[model samples]
Target: MDKSHNLERHLMSRKGEHNYSATVIWTGNSGEGTKHYRAFSRDHEITCGSKPTIKGSSDPAFRGDSSRYNPEELLLSSLSACHMLWYLHLCADSGITVSNYSDHAEGRMIETQNGSGHFEKVLLKPVVNIGTSDDKDLAKSLHDKAHSFCFIANSVNFDVRCEPEIVVG
Candidate 1:
């Protein structure tokens, strides 16, 4: 089963089903002795989480007073996850062995322009750490390819930055 004839591309869509939605259960324990909780929506009812609270209404990681994954933080995760998936696929197709993978993403939200008083301009920062037994150039190229093919990165109108530091171990 050589790789030459196995070349193929694919298409994927998320949230396609009307009843599909991920609700991260927040049990009021943030692993650091803090009470935080919230939930997402799939329909009109927003009664998933404990509602009407000054505390459990936000994400702790996003500096939210409570603890639910914020829309912005979810954006960062989506992009990072997409990049990681593509990176691994590219590596496998290129016959590269990846021993480790991790990405820490951050987004900077600024004020919206045109007299809008809300925040805007999310700058996605993805610091990727990967270990591979392939040529350094190939690894770098795979990173580049992943960045180029990441759907979430292309769907947004923000400045997405990928600082890929590859290592062979």
Candidate 2:
């Protein structure tokens, strides 16, 4: 029940490594198959085992369908989801009873003159609602640890900043 014991148990349970995989199938081929620059579509499908296929496409700036999910948006969503999951886990282990949690994350990408671009920064604004008994300071402090442990955040070259707000409910 104590903090130290809980932290120790949490650390001990994650000693093993993990692996993940996914498949992307291009469904474009608008009957021409890249014969010209505008001949083919950028539509594709992403699948992971038995899960539902995610409709994917290039950004509309690249002549893709605006109705589909773009790669840039997916990358930002991955980072946001990873951070939120780790934060919730850490809160549970640390005895912070979170009633509600939400994040409005944003990412900024800069395109170069050569038509290539990279994400410059990502801001994760997490608003956490915790039980009245929880320590608000401790809840706020956990965001740093969560970001440090997030796999997607650690893999990205751009800076990922967390601006968390803690509310006792």
Candidate 3:
């Protein structure tokens, strides 16, 4: 098959719409139930079809529990996971053998004086362990392709940058 035709077919096959559903149940209502600014906790549960429930809360800065997962952390995790999945797929297709992968992602959000905030940027630091060092350059280069294909990174308005460390094991 011609390369151009194959490329076109591959691109067309990847075009589609995906839908996700989640239900957030508020478990923070104190007895007063928002009668005052501090009347309620910031705890909640996030549920999706048949999956285990996720305990959630606002950031501790907003009077939330420190032990629960926050939205900011979840968003960062989503971006990291999406990029990792894409990177693994590209690596396999490119003949790079990956043994293990991990990422430490960070995000910066600026809070306005009026209480609104938005994420300015996110940094993904992925440490990928491979079977050999021969394809180190190719492995590193796949991060860019993965970022381009990541759904969560593409959906966010802020910049999501990746700095990958390739390790041979």
Per lDDT, the best of the predicted structures is 2
Score each candidate by Cα lDDT. 0.60, 0.92, 0.91
Identify the runs in model 2 with alpha carbons over 4 angstroms from their true place: 1-5
Ranking by lDDT: 2, 3, 1
User: What TM-score does structure 2 among the candidates reach?
Assistant: 0.92
Name the 10 consecutive residues with the lowest summed lDDT in model 3: 1-10
Q: 1 or 3, which is superior by TM-score?
A: 3
- Clash totals for all candidate models: 2, 0, 0
| Lowest-sum lDDT 10-residue window in model 1 | 37-46
User: What does each candidate score in C-alpha RMSD?
Assistant: 8.8, 1.6, 2.1
What lDDT tens digits, residue by residue, belong to model 3 across residues 56-138?
99999999899999999999999999999989988877778999999999999999999999999999999999886558998
TM-score of each: 0.59, 0.92, 0.92
* Candidate 1 accuracy as TM-score: 0.59
Question: Which ranges of candidate 1 are over 4 A from the true structure?
Answer: 1-56, 59-63, 113-133
